[model samples]
Target: MNRRKSREIAMKLLFEISINTNDVSETIENYKENNENFDDVDFAYVENILDGVAKNNEFLNKTIEGNLTNWKLSRISKVNMSILKIAVYEICFQEDIPSKVSANEAVNLAKKYSDDKSPSFINGVIGNIIKLK
Candidate 1:
């Protein structure tokens, strides 16, 4: 599939991992086994995101927390947090992907999976992250 779709799946996987605290590779393997459309997805991209984000979660959280004006990382919804993690991972680690694109995709994911206010909130956080980067 396209990068957008790959990101969507990665976001979902991140959300699952955040909640379940499962082994990343095992979770991804199970997801692949269950998902019929797995063939279309860019597994390389997804795996990179999953492994990178998992490996660097503490740093990512600190970066996100530092960028926040008044909110704690715990205050953010899990779904929004997952979205932010993916975007942040892309911005910080994926040299091929533009920061703006990562931020935009994050806002799109928030709009789809989070509440109405989440899009703007995510946009603001990502904007701050881009500025800091």
Candidate 2:
């Protein structure tokens, strides 16, 4: 799959791991085993996101929390948190991906998986993070 589709899968896996507290590698392997369409999914990118976010969970959370305006980390939904973590991971750790692309993909993910207001909230927070970078 394309990067966008890979991102979606990564976000979903991240969301699942966030709630279940499962082993990221194990969960990814299981996901791949269960899903028939593995040819299109970018497992490398997906693994990068999953591993990157898990490795830098605290830093990512602090970065996101620091960028939020009048919002606490605990108050954020799991889906939004998952999306934010992936984007933050990409923006901070992945040198090849542009920060704006990360931000935009994050907003798109929020729009698809989060509530109505989540898109703008995610955009604003990511925008702030990018500006600070």
Candidate 3:
């Protein structure tokens, strides 16, 4: 699959992990059955995102909460929040992936999966994050 498709899948898997709060391993097993096109790299990205977000949730949420202008973290949709978390993590941690690429992919994902407000909302949060860091 292409990079964008990989990211889309990763976002979906992360969203799944967010909503379910089940064990990651079990969730992956179930997700895998439905994902016929996934490869090891795809799995790595999903696992990295899911585990990284879970590991750094407190810090990430704190950072996001502080950066949001008027919206509370809890007020954000779970799917949009998951997309933002994964994209922001990539921006903050994955030096190899350009911040611009991360931000663009996030906007694209938001446009595809979220409402009209999501792209800008995500872009603002991520822009602030990149600025702060």
* Clash counts for all predictions: 1, 2, 0
Candidate 1 lDDT over 1-133, as tens digits, reads: 6899999999999899988998778888989888786667898899999999989999999999999988899999999999999999999999999999999999999989999999999999999999988
Weakest 10 consecutive residues, lDDT, candidate 1? 32-41
Model 2 RMSD vs true structure? 0.9
- Judged by lDDT, which candidate is best? 2
Per-candidate Cα lDDT values, in order, are 0.92, 0.93, 0.83
Candidate 3 ranges with C-alpha deviation above 4 Å: 39-41
For model 2, the stretches where C-alpha displacement exceeds 4 angstroms are: none
Q: lDDT per residue, candidate 3, 6-111, as tens digits?
A: 6787788778878887866777789777757565346666677778878888887887888899888889998898888888888877888899899999999999
Q: Write the per-residue lDDT of candidate 2 for residues 1-133, one digit (tens) a residue.
A: 6999999999999999988899888889889888887777899989888998999999999999999999999999999999999999999999999999999999999988999999999999999999999
User: How high a TM-score does candidate 2 get?
Assistant: 0.96
CA lDDT for candidate 3: 0.83
Candidate 1, backbone clash total: 1
C-alpha-based local distance difference test score of model 1: 0.92
Ranking by TM-score: 2, 1, 3
- TM-score for all models, in order of appearance: 0.96, 0.96, 0.91
